[model samples]
Structures are given as structure tokens and as C-alpha cells.
Target: MTTHPAPTVHDVRHEETGEGQPTTGLDAFAVCALSGAYSAVAEARRFTAAILEGWGVCAPVVSDAVLVVSELTGNALRHAAPRGPDAAESRPDLVCAAWLALAHQEAGVLCAVSDSSRAVPALAAPDLMAEEGRGLWIIDRLSESWGWTRPDHTGKTVWAQLPVPRPTR
Candidate 1:
């Protein structure tokens, strides 16, 4: 199996205060690099939960968020490995690298997992006893809204937005 490096995450935000200076806001964002390994799914799940908790997202939503992250990240790793087209120049000869981002929106939390493929995900009718092919189904049912987008940079991103309980970090 080939391994790729995880990218460093960065955040840039603009905020304001009473005197238009700076004040804390409810919005939050976090990102992490993911390798196309099976274990990255678990890491995605844990990362989602941690970010939600840190942002004071309620417990029930946090659980759902974890599941969403796991499913999307798993699917990306499964399908987008051994990078083909739209490979970044800086990271050429890539076996496959991915990224996961979580943003705390005013109405809900948005979780996105992006990989090096433009293929869209569809709901698969897996056998009742089957262990695989249920990721998209779970994401559809749990999230308030979900969709996939092909970014200008490279590959596609599968995203799920979950409505979180109002609270503070």
C-alpha cells in the first residue's frame, strides 16, 4: 500500500466587536489531512466528534456527525485512491490523499470529505446482510441536507449538514 502525507490545516476568519474591533463568534472551522487508508475513516469520525464538542454542538448531533464523517471518509478512501486525474503538481506521484473539513454554520454543522475523484456517490441497495455499500444511505437519512460538489482545485467533496442544538463552547 502507498502512503501520502496529510496536509496542514489553516483557518482565516474575520470577526467584529462592540466597537467593530473583535469578538468571538459562534462559527467554527477545522480541517485535517487524510490518507487513503481504512483507518482514516475512524480518524475522520473522531475528528468530527471532537470538533462538534469543542464548538458546543449538542450530544445527539455529535453522534450523528461522527457517523456522517465515517461514512463519507470511508467512501472517499475506497474510491479515490491511487490518484488519477486532477492530481496536484506539488503532490505528484500521489497514491491518494484526502482532506476533511468541519464548519459550524449558524443553522447547522457542515462536514465535508474531499478526495481525488470526480465520481459522484449514489445510494446503493445493498443486501440486507451486507456490510458495505450503506454509507451513502446512512448519510442521506441522518443529515438535514447532503450533496457532492466538484471543486475547482481537484476531485469532489461529499458534504452533510446536520442541524445542531444551539449552545456555546
Candidate 2:
């Protein structure tokens, strides 16, 4: 999977507050571009863990964020198409790409996955013994809140926020 370097994290003052405090939530974020391969799911999890840890996110929140990222990335890879006129065309030589973004909030971390499909993710009522169709349910149970957005017609992004305890610093 091809990945992009995260933007440097630095103290970002809130313009309205006029205080030199650090930026949180969407203002300070990290993103990874995932290739079409299934391995992208694992890569997204690893990326999430590293970024959250580096940002001093607590262990439990980091764990939840990683799982959420994995499920979202996996769903996108399995069900969504790349944005383009040729999106439906199968090209063995070319791999589709998805994007994963993680932002550190004051009390939680926000995770989002963007894919080229306009289809919204829905919860499926699978049988109790079914191995599939449980991603969204798991996300709902683990996240404080989760939802999706369509930024234009070319794609959709599913996002989740995982609560974290404030640090003692």
C-alpha cells in the first residue's frame, strides 16, 4: 500500500481564543492513502496505532481507533470503487486507492475513511452465526459516535469518534 507522510504536528492556536494552545480534533490530523490490496486493512491499523501513540493518545483509545480504522478501510476496499469514468472497469495492473484520516480531539480521536463510492454504509442484520456483516455493529459498540458524509458526488467518508481520558499533563 502506498502511504503519505503525516503533516507535522505543532502547537496551533485557536484564532478565536487567542491562546497558544495546541490544536485538537480535525485541526490536527494524520492521513494514509491505501492501495486496493486487502493488506491495506492491516496497514491502516498499524498506521492508526502509531499515529495515536505518537500523539499521546491513551492505550484503550488507540486500540479502538485501530480497530475502527481497520473495519472502515476493509469495508471500503471490499465494497467501494475508485472515483473515475473508468472506475467500473477492472484493470488487474492498476490498484484502487482509499484514504484514512485520524484526528486527535481534546477528549477523543476521530477516525475517518474515504472511498470513491457514493454508496452509504449501512448496518446489515445478519444471522447470529454469520461471519460477515458485523463491521458496522462493532463500530457502533466501540465508538462514542459514528456516521458518514458525502463530500461531493464522487465519494463518501465514514467517520467515528472514540473517547479518551484527558492526560494528567
Q: TM-score for all predictions?
A: 0.74, 0.76
lDDT computed for candidate 1: 0.77
lDDT of 1 by residue, 60-132 (tens): 9999999989988888888876544553565685544789999988889888888877677777676779868
Model number with the top lDDT: 1
Q: Model 1 segments beyond 4 Å from truth?
A: 1-26, 83-96, 151-153, 167-169
| Root mean square deviation (Cα) for candidate 2 | 7.6
Q: How does residue 101 of candidate 2 score in lDDT?
A: 90
Residue-wise C-alpha lDDT for candidate 2, range 41-93, written one tens digit per residue: 99999999999999888888888888889889989988884544675574433
lDDT of 1 at 87: 39
Candidate 1 least-lDDT 10 residues: 1-10
Candidate 1's TM-score: 0.74
Q: How many backbone clashes does candidate 2 have?
A: 1
